[model samples]
Target: MTYSGDVTPGGAPAVRELSGLTVSKLSVGPMDNNAYLLTCRSTGDQVLIDAANEAPRLLELIGGDGLDAVITTHRHMDHWVALEEVVAKTGARALVHADDAEGLPIPAETLTEGDTVPVGDCALEVIHLRGHTPGSIALLYRDPAGTPHLFTGDSLFPGGVGNTDKDPERFAALIDDVERKLFGRLPDDTWFYPGHGKDSTLGAERPALPQWRARGW
Candidate 1:
């Protein structure tokens, strides 16, 4: 039950602390999906992204701390496998974009582009980026020191954008949204936390934009 340990089994090995925000990442489920817990240190208010799987393990991570909300980045099953149980146990509200609400097992509050999700004193600004899913969204938080932290569901990754339909139009739309909504607006030092893998910064992925566009994937 200690805070911030990097090398323990079933524990979040990768932890990042900034301002009053603390992010702990755990790889869960058969797909090895990444679930994140964002906590506001000042008020102890917390939010979780992608419950994915292993409810017991997730409950362990929660460690009796009350959760404010459990947000589903998209409608994909892999991202929500443990959502129902977690929500039931924690009494946390489920939040998802309106476009993908019907896909969830239980009811969810509507979330749209430009909305703000309150986490204690912190406000997580929403950015609805389409193509990976009609409702795919990312959350942005600017810490006290002016550093930006982004939670980019499955629409973006370290190397390129998320998996998309084979249709050329679908691929084009995703790339365009990512370029305009993410790369074009965010700063180079912005740290992004994705749904299923390693974290990456805007600076690391900026240079590959053109290459990704050319590949059309």
Candidate 2:
């Protein structure tokens, strides 16, 4: 089936396709945060990104498919409330950043910048993007056809950016990182899947960087 739209309750965005890897978006929590499901076509292996608050719904989505791992973008409760339950239901290993790995309900395999995580025949590179949280990360992956994909949690958004009000220095750093690391290097065609709002391309967001910067983060 072709993947599109929010598949979970509360208008969460999700996209799945049998052709390549499938990506499902789940809306969780009072804030309506987005969680993702990435499935490998070659091996039917899957990885869950940010469990949110809908454990039962996430489990149903994983039905029959072998869940290999769960990745948390950061330590925020809105992003990880259901992480333990999903791990228990799918028997999948958890992957998180070392900075925020502690205090999680489940054991997790810590990931750092420059690390590559494999699922089936595909691999996702971990990019440390602090600001929204000390351990926030963006997962970058390339499809078989060389299409670049970036799963940016609260770190980035279309037209807008992640909330960094928790710390001024951290927020400033995050803005700088987004400008240099993400917007500067990545191709315009790169697909940006954010933690909230609709999806957009790097090309689309490039023009808006100045505005975001002008706002002073």
Top of the candidates by lDDT: 1
Per-residue C-alpha lDDT of model 2 across residues 1-217, encoded as one tens digit per residue: 4444434346535665634677777776666778888888878889988887778777877778768999998888788888988888888899999988985777899999989888787788999887888888999887757568899999998776799885668778888888887888789988878876567889988988888777867
Q: List the residue pairs that clash in candidate 1.
A: none
Quote the lDDT for 189 in model 2: 87
Tell me the spans in candidate 2 whose CA falls farther than 4 Å from its real position: 1-8, 11-13
Against the correct fold, how does model 2 do in TM-score? 0.91
Prediction RMSDs, each to the true structure: 2.6, 2.2
- Kindly give the number of clashing pairs for every candidate: 0, 4
TM-score of each: 0.94, 0.91
lDDT of 1 by residue, 1-217 (tens): 5433233335454777778888888888588788888888889999998898888888788777799999899999999989999999999999999999998889999899999998888889889888888899999998878669899989999999988977688788889988998888989998888887678889999999999999888
